[model samples]
Target: MFLAATTAGDRVRANPGGQAFCPSCMADLIPKCGEIKVWHWAHRTDDCDPWSEPESQWHIDWKTRFGLQNCEVVMGPHRADVVARDGLVIELQHSHISPEEIAERQRFYRRMIWVVDAGEFREHVDLRLASIRTDPYRQQPTTYRSFRWRWPRPTHARFTSPLFWDFGDGTMLNVRKIHPETPCGGWGYLWTKPQFVRRFAVHVDELGDALEDGATA
Candidate 1:
């Protein structure tokens, strides 16, 4: 994780010898500000959130976009990747996940979505223009495209939450739905980075309100 809680309950980024605790379990955290990997905090023992994978630069970049307070949010016994002001949990997935684990997270968060790092599979995935129609999400004329993976990941078939695929580009593929056909394919809406963030995250001006609500709650 990039941030840990101070004794005063304030969220802070990792610093050398920074004494902090895990927001989810109150466990002592070791500040890992190495020159090699991404600077982050690690629990002295084990991670409180079993769903958490090792943070990569990809994860850090996305979390940075959402801001520290909004990322790594504690909800009950688990720490969410990103929780919007409207109570939407956004899970950033980069590593391989089991179908059963995906279902478990959906059940835990209840109201959640996924922003998957699909760069690794981008080369194997094919996109075709399906139609040129008015996109209800963007409220504009958009080019709808259908995506098909040469060899689809089994986990993709079990996804129940809304999913957006990020391919290291400045745009996102908002998957409308997965196709049931033999060669797995789906039609989706395309969104720019700014558009998706604006539509999902709380406005910068309202971040104070979000923080206050979290503090008070």
Candidate 2:
């Protein structure tokens, strides 16, 4: 509960592969909330291997590679352990931070990336679990599938869900959006919280064409 207790709204990251590995229970997972966020890591069964810890070595590697320094290991706000680097709060699974911490850290860089370790999944866990989408599986999942980001003053960063279709390429021609106001047709445009303007539709044919035609510098 440290995740919920400590870092309430401290920016949540999604369990990539659309699944999580519960430390308390060992099995494949279905996200608890209406959607998935690492802080909401849980298992349908009672016994699951949690993403809890000082944090996994994979997460450590990600931090080091990304240049995190003087990190502290404390539970979200009221539990276990969390790592905070350069004013950025790093929560593994449910490592939550306090509202005060969030407000204070807002002035600095508010960036964090949730991680999934390839070595920790079940034997039955498919490497393509994320791509499987609606397929059936028996093992609990462990992989960083999706990412959620937040910024204090609103950043120019954004992402869109991939598009699908029956065109010659079998890929959806989506659309390119620099911001939420950019006008996306049938496909949806996604924007991170706070700014709520930076949005995009992944793999848009327009973007692809722009890149191919060298319209994008």
Q: Highest TM-score: which candidate?
A: 1
Best by lDDT: 1
What would the per-residue lDDT of candidate 1 be over residues 59-176, giving only the tens digit for each residue?
A: 8877867677789999888889998759899999999999899999999999998999989988877988768789886688776888887777767867889888897776678888
**Backbone clash count for every predicted candidate, in the order shown:** 0, 29
Q: Write the per-residue lDDT of candidate 2 for residues 1-217, one digit (tens) a residue.
A: 1121112313222333444332222244444343322234344554222323433333443333222222222323222122333333443322343444444433332343222221222232221213212211112221222212122112111312221111112111121222323231122122211111011112233333223323211
Shift in Å, residue 188, candidate 1: 0.9
Model 2: how far residue 114 lies from native, Å: 2.5
Clashes of 1: 0
Q: What TM-score would candidate 1 get against the native?
A: 0.89
